[model samples]
Target: MRFVIKVGTSLIAPGGRIDTVLMRALVDQLDLERHEYLIVSSGAIASGMSKLAFSAKPKSVRLMQACAAVGQSLLMYTYEQLFFGKKVVAQLLLSSDDFTSALRYENLQHALHELLKLGVVPIVNENDSVSVRELVGAFGDNDELSALLATAVKADWLVLLTNVDGFYDSAGRGQKLVRTVRRLTPKMEALCGEKSELGTGGMRSKLRAAMMASENGVQVAIANGTAPQAIRNAIERKIGTYFPATKPAPKKRAKAAD
Candidate 1:
């Protein structure tokens, strides 16, 4: 089954730059799998900040957008370099507007279908350069974008790779991790905190995004991105917090014309 994987900035860029080694390891495992894979990544802004030598994070929207524009190319280039001999990888930067309009949505889906059909892995990310403040949450972040992309592509599973192992009982206070959460509740919402240092969209946003994925008939999981063969393990149901598909599965649809 095809999978849409969302790799958070924390896992990809722990500091202010891209963590090439970790990224390569993850990509290596994905290359070994026969299943079709799509990656939704977040690290452009951080990458840009480093390249531009910005002492601190961008404050103004214009500055942030500029950094995003600059970083997106570098980020994609790094991915291309890493997967140079592995597979054909393509960059797909999106914004909420791309999904809001019916025409754009259909067009985007067709493009993605063609890419996947050609055995090319599509790397998607939000267009943070021209991002709207209203779209900064899970829906706007790569985490939520990945979940939505999974539904858009009719993927079988939605895997979210983050710094944390999985959803916890409390906001990092409780020692217990929610290994399997059948249903996300309000209490769980309270337990989740804000986003991490390396990324935006915290546990709260992830839970919210998971609800959207579950409603769209996609099985979701939250796992540590740095784990050894984490994606493969998650597929085998071997690790992290596994959230069952509570919604109906996607139905077969006509393929886009070649």
Candidate 2:
């Protein structure tokens, strides 16, 4: 199965520092020979903050971009080290235009498919160092990006790995995990809480992304990134809030003759 796994900043760099041990554990779970995996990770800024000794995420756009510039390298380097001798990994820094523009989108699809064909794991993130949209509250902290990538790549599963186990039902006396959500509703939106301090997206943004991917025929699972074998469990529907695809995936049409 092809999976677009999104790991949030909170899990990647809790306390504003990259957790190499935790990251190694996550990497250890990858079964590259059995399935294809693409990672959409968010942590360049946080990793930068750590390297620069910034206590918190900077409000200044330029400063945040600078942080991304510094951290993106560190982030990819770490991934490269972890995946060494296991699988070749490629870094893809993307912007909204990559998806919005027709030519760019087609080119991106071709590139991604080609990389996958070579058995390379693509590590994607927003081009935060240059993209104002991404740095300034766009892409919902890479949630939307993952969904869009999943749709474009025709991924069978889009697993959103976060701190939470799954979406919850907070209306009752205590919060109850909602195992399956076939369709999104107004109530789900109402249940959303605030965004994370370290990360831009919260449950609200995740739900929105989930709705988008599910509608595009990509099954989505919002599961806890910190959980043991989280990726495996999420794909198997053993944990997290599963959103089954609602629409059929559009068949890829052959290019017309010039």
- Which candidate achieves the best TM-score against the true structure? 2
Q: What is the lDDT of residue 158 in candidate 1?
A: 89
> Please, what is the TM-score per model?
0.93, 0.95
Candidate 1 colliding pairs: none
lDDT of 1 by residue, 3-74 (tens): 899999887766678899999888888743477889998988888888888867776768777778888898
- Error (Å) of candidate 1 at residue 89 is 1.0
What residue runs in model 1 are displaced by over 4 Å at the alpha carbon?
A: 31-33, 134-140, 172-174, 252-257
Alpha-carbon shift of residue 95 in model 1 (angstroms): 0.8
Q: Which residue pairs clash within candidate 2?
A: none
- Model 1: which ten-residue window has the lowest total lDDT? 131-140
Clashes within 3 Å, all models in order: 0, 0
Tell me the tens digit of each residue's lDDT in model 2 across 147-193: 99999989888999999898998855788999988877898889988
The lDDT for every candidate, in the order shown, is 0.81, 0.90
**lDDT, model 1, position 34:** 72
